[model samples]
Target: MYVTTSGRIHNFGAGPATLPLQVVEECQNALPNLNESGFGLMEISHRSETFQEIIDSAMGRLRRILTIPDEYTVLFLQGGASLQFYMSALNLLRPGDHVDFLVTGAWSQKAMKEANRIGDASPRWDDSENGFKSIPKNGEYSIRNDAMYVHYTSNNTLFGTQYHHLPDSDGKPRVLDASSDIAGVPIDVSAHDLIYAGAQKNLGPSGVTIVILSPWAMKRVGDDLPTMLDYSVHSSKGSLFNTPNTFGIFVLDRVLNWVEENGGLEGSVARNIAKSNLLYEELDRSSFWKPHAKKDSRSVMNVTWRLPNEKLEEKFLQEATIAGLGGLKGHRSVGGIRASLYNGCSIKSVEALVIFMRNFEQANH
Candidate 1:
């Protein structure tokens, strides 16, 4: 396994992925006595004033970094993006309401299935037959005229595909599950009515999910919704309707602080692009590297590919783990190899990966 002199591995897991060393160190420091308040990071009371300050800072920094509209409401909740898959539909949709989904990958397919529980959810565009290799262009699908909203996943972690442009929603509201590529790529916050992402990938650790909602989305929320699933309830109480993931929120805040200090969203986007380009360059250099996603649909955050055969792929993963290039294995559903380059991943890690890839190719070929 490849180990840095600092004793850290080059992490490339999809979710709960890499984090900035600085953030991790800060969390370590805070764990003993948070803000010198005689409270451990994980033991602090969620209702305490100090903890309140941490959550407030996190929300404010996220808004600034994402350039969220002043009118939009941001909530930090638990249960990850999976819960949001159901809660978003529960809150924004009603019985018999029609919703169109652009099923680019596995996550969107799940999102559509959850939405179908509440309303008529139809796939406006599904790429499953094509192995989810590419995203659709604007005119590639038709949104139902009476659709209540359009739902999509901005990035497909399982398939290494991403939408480079905002999807066409036919002027209807858009809901996005941006679990894998939220802050690592360019996104138009104002364009989406509702957006949810689990913090494990680009933002921080697991357990905390970020939800951003426009005024229209809040306005559209049906009455008498379940308290925990209701956006309005969570927004009204500032996401403190119930006890939250204190440690995760604190870590997330530190991650956002790191992002702000390192040139904010623009810096992350450029770095991610550079990292993916390095891997894609090596992939294109030889037919031995078989990338899963098409060129225009390649994801900057999660890069997936295969070897010439299953045996070689297994050999590659074994050697990769032995070399300390960790978390290079792909999702089990479509196993091959995947390298996730989230916001906290550095260019140095990418460089190491490329060098190792070249060496491996030479030895194996």
Candidate 2:
């Protein structure tokens, strides 16, 4: 395992999660005077040419990494993916229009509730009763003929479940909340009409949400929509419709630069797979570790599991934190353990975690 000279421990928090050290360092350097423009990063004006170049670089790098279509519009908006839940529905739906959801976890549940405010949003497939341990196969759900679009979360951060295939949307437009696994996994940008992700997890930091809109989605925006919630408005202004998250965008751009330098999207996917595989292998090695998600639906980013009991789980968390590993606690909604192996999480960190798990299991058992 690679030990940090700066004495930073491994972080496994779900969001506002770990970031690449190089990116963090770059941000640190820019804090004083970004690009020697004499304006501190946090103090840089959104309308300034220097900041314009930063946003452009970030967007351009994101497009290249994801291979987003030329016609697709990308916006770096605030309010995170939570806002997109309502905004997406508000822009895409009118009264009486139907929308279908594949509710895999809490976030999707919240999304469905928000969408209901706009139209007849209902879950076509919901795995909540089964403890959100698996993703539904295509045939398990049915889409309504009148459905305007089919929405699904690509990865459930809390439950450690992820979809490994493109969902069957019955030829309807597909809207996705890829918040937890945007550039970290394999995604066909052309397949979905709209995709939104919170940059904190796999991209950079909180306060910025990336939204991609297909031409179809843009044209479908309801007339007289709220100016800020309207996609076309942001698209017209190049995501500068408001003040924007200048600091977050700058960090995100640095993170993307790190991705490009290390190996683009393919590299990120491989690294995440390798990290998750190491941890999952340890979880599978002993009965002491009970993984939350089913094998077929396991997440490559966040790995969730449990110990023999709450006492053991608590003991594990405490000891792990003392051992220089942190943020392994599970979501309060489903208490256990969760280690998020995002793009920024190093393989060395996973290796260190696996070693800790092995020692803890043996000692506790």
Candidate 3:
């Protein structure tokens, strides 16, 4: 059996990213028989009281950490944010109902496409002209007051851009896809009508998605929606409408507990800012490296940059991998180096990466 030893490499993958070592260890200890239920976590039934406790604990901790408002219902459901792209449209919009989208990067573009398939989705504004390096100015988008909802991705993982401030929806319900940077930073949950995130990034493992929605948003859900695709159905049943991702939820619960113990959303945001600043400062100090995103729009969670050329980037990736720094390669759609500094990434790891970057630049230049 494979075991995580003290020699674990610093992970920088975007999703399925690194998790707190303490959480992993706790899960390891409980895998055999969770809560002394005589059955392993994977072997237990989802309908059991033990599993209910686990899910409830996960929800409570998430609420405490994020300060989720009392009016919003949190549902831990199957399918990643991709499913939510369509599910949100199905429940909240109908044929000919217009939904405004702010396309910042690949993920938001996909979200718009999905919404378009179900409703009259149109881009309020797109930053494609700038290669998505910066977010659109506040007044740039022409938002329609008649639109049912406005959808946006909080952080663009591919382009390394993030919206520092949310758009003014002008009383329109806002749907936010916060998959990449959910728990890594603080957000006003009440500011959004619907917020969805895939668990793999900052929350936990893959296979589960977290959806937090207000009662106002739930009331707008379309009638005769598919049983599983209906947000109201899952919310009504307390996310126990069907067999959920038991193991994933279990890990997520432990991860949230880790977040609370360390501090909360505010604490996590401070840590993320410090880590990203370290890397950004180092990148700015070196001409050999070029950060992809603009200064104000850069993502605290995913710091993407490029070397002088593709050959240099390839060499850097190879050397970094051998030096125990892995998953530095960026997404294939946008080829470059991306060091994702998720919540689980420690400041020491960022410092080590910055040191490696400086040495690499010096040796090459």
The lDDT per prediction is 0.92, 0.94, 0.90
- List candidate 3 segments past 4 Å from native: 1-5
Model 1 misses residue 137 by how many Å?
Answer: 0.2
Task: Output the better candidate (1/2) by lDDT.
Answer: 2
Better of 1 and 3 by TM-score: 1
Over 1-365, each residue of candidate 1 has an lDDT whose tens digit, in order, gives: 55888799898988788899999999989989999999999899989999999999999999999999999999999998999989999988889999999999889988989999999999989999999999999999999999999999999999999999988999999999999988888888999999999999999999999999999999989998877888888898999999999999999999999999998999999999989999899999999999999999999989999988999989988888788788899998778999999998899988988988899899988
- Would you estimate the TM-scores of all the predictions? 0.99, 0.99, 0.97
Model 3 per-residue lDDT tens digits across residues 1-365: 11125677888899899999998888888889998998898988999999999999999999988889988899999889999999999989889899999999989999999998889999988888888898877888778878999998999988899989978776788999999999897788989999999999898999999999988888888889889999888988999999999999999999999888887888889999999999999989967888999898999999999888999999999888877788899998778899999989889888878888888888998
Cα lDDT for residue 192, candidate 2 = 98
Worst-scoring 10-residue span by lDDT in model 2 = 1-10
Output the lDDT of residue 143, model 2: 98
252: Cα error in model 3, Å? 0.6
RMSD of each: 0.8, 1.3, 1.9
Steric clash count of candidate 2 = 0
